[model samples]
Target: MIKKITCNNGLRIISEDISHVRSVAVGIWVQAGSRYELPQENGLTHFIEHMLFKGTATRSAKQIAEEFDRIGGNINAFTSKENTCYYAKVLDHHAKHAVEILADMFFNSLFDPNEIEKERLVVLEEINMVEDTPDDIVHEYLWREMYENNPLGSPILGTEETLNSFTKEMILSYMERHYTPDNVVISVAGNIQEGFLEYIESLFGQYKSVKKPVKSLETPAIKPIYTENFRETEQAHICIAYPGLSINADNIYSLVVLNNILGGSMSSRLFQEIREDKGLAYSIYSYHSSYEDTGVVVVYGGTSSNQLNELKTSIFDSIENVMNKGFTETEILNSKEQLKGNLLLSLESTNARMSRNGKNELLYGKHRTLDEVSETIDEVTLESVVDLAKEIFSHKPAISIIMPKKVDL
Candidate 1:
């Protein structure tokens, strides 16, 4: 069962008590991400994520690492377009110790001047690493084309100019605005110890931010523009994207089912046709990225520059076929069953449960039972999927391609 408690300061805690497991996973979710940043502050949230691990008031960075190592616990954090999470998984006996360490990192990070300069260089190298990889950097170009001038289009790893300009004062100011109690959620899953909830509350509940969390109202309008990057790479990377639904869309299951039939699996149409049948590409897939107010479905393929046209043509043909003919009853059924199976399999992990509960609480503030989700997946019919496909495919897709500089268009 899942339980929730809101602290006096407005921090929300959600947990699932799985008494059978001997491990516990705890995540601290904050609504601080690239999307909330001003144009000048792009990647600030991700930078802050790195800074939190450098050192805290009472623990050196190495000490924090050693403490987790001592308990045989796993500790890490990630920054996304929508939020940031710092999580730890440990044996249930070490749960309190893990939480204390996380709280220390969260509330007491020094963000020392020397550390900031060193980490800035580290992040610059990270950015350069991505720039050197064509396949990875192509998606960043796609977002720039799709969202145009919106902050949503900006990369989570800010550019060198912005990174160099970020001062300690700036970091603190951004946190003061977005890292409020109301914008944070603590999610715990697995064999929760007695008084664990109170323990967490005692650690996280007292602190409160005076500033209200600010969200950007600038909704990104899709620009179905074709953009290309010329790189001296062996293969041409391409991404075809269509506008999709929001996280809370009612027909989200239908879209998921449709994506599966298109390119989600090895048996999927894009994989079977593009890779297996024609040998056009080795890596080809489709996925949906849904946000709060809107989403996008992207089909990605990488092929030799000489075969780039064929790859692009084949992908379009597959999408056109699906839109024109729709999916068979068997395809819809199998996709739904596959999704249900994946969902069931993921529940065995405390980490997965912690993440799911954390994201759902952070985004929707509601939880659906396993049966409820399975039922929703089961309810996705062929007609619903086909209709959604038609609607999604009707739009002019935004296209992004990265090709060898010598390959002439």
Candidate 2:
């Protein structure tokens, strides 16, 4: 069973006890990310994520790593477009230690000036790495084209210029505004310990601050723009994006089903036709990125410069066929079963369960069980899937391509 506790300070703790596993996965989910950042503060959230592990008031960076190693566990964190997560997976007996370390970093990071300068260089190199990789950078370009001036379109890594401008004072100020109790969720799954609830309360309850509600995102009204950059690479990278449904939309399940049939798996239409039949590309797939108020469907692939047009045409043909002819009953049923199987299989992992709990609560203000999610997927009918396909494909495609400079268009 899953349980949630909201402390007096407004920090929400949600957990599930699974007796079968001896490990527990704990995550601190803060409702702050690139979307919450100002234009001048594009990558501040991701930057702060890096700084938290640098050190705390009582622990050095090396000490933090050694401690987690002593516990025989894992600790890591990531920043997304809408939220940031710092998590640890450890033996059940060490849950309190992990939580304490996390709380220490959360409440008392030193953000030493020396560490800031070193990490700034580190992040600059990170930005260089992304810029050099065509496939990775193309998606960032696609979002920029799709959302235009919106924060949602901005890269989480920010630009080198922005990274250089960030200071310790700026980092502290950003954290102060965004890291309030009401904007955080502590999620845990697997062998939850006795007295863990009170232990969590004691650690987090004393820290108190009120946060303003997240500002509403301005919807982008820009038309789809095609971006092509001439580069000298062995293969041309392609990324195509279209508008998609939001996380809480009624048609979300249908969109999931739609993406699967389109290019989600090796057996998907794009994969089978573009790669298997035509022998065009080795990597090809479709994905849906759903945010709170909006979402996007993206299809990405790579091919030789000579075959780029064929690959692009084939992708569009696949979508056109689905939109006009629609998927057969068997296709819809199989995709539904596939989604259900994926969800059920993931629940067996403590980390997956903990992540699902945190994300659902943060995004929807409620938690959903595996059964409930399966039912939601099952409710998607072929008609609904086809209708959603039409709705999603109705928008013009935003295309981003990076090709060799010498290659003729």
For candidate 1, the TM-score is 0.99
Whole-model lDDT per candidate: 0.94, 0.90
Cα lDDT tens digits, model 2, 335-367, are 999999988887888999999999988889897
| Maximum-TM-score candidate | 1
lDDT of 1 by residue, 346-382 (tens): 8889999999999999999999999999999999899
Per-candidate TM-score against the hidden true structure: 0.99, 0.98
Alpha-carbon RMSD to native, per candidate = 0.9, 1.2
Measured with C-alpha atoms, the lDDT of residue 26 in candidate 2 is 93
After superposition, the stretches of candidate 1 with alpha carbons farther than 4 Å from their true spots are: 406-409
Tell me how candidate 1 scores on lDDT: 0.94
| Best model number under lDDT | 1
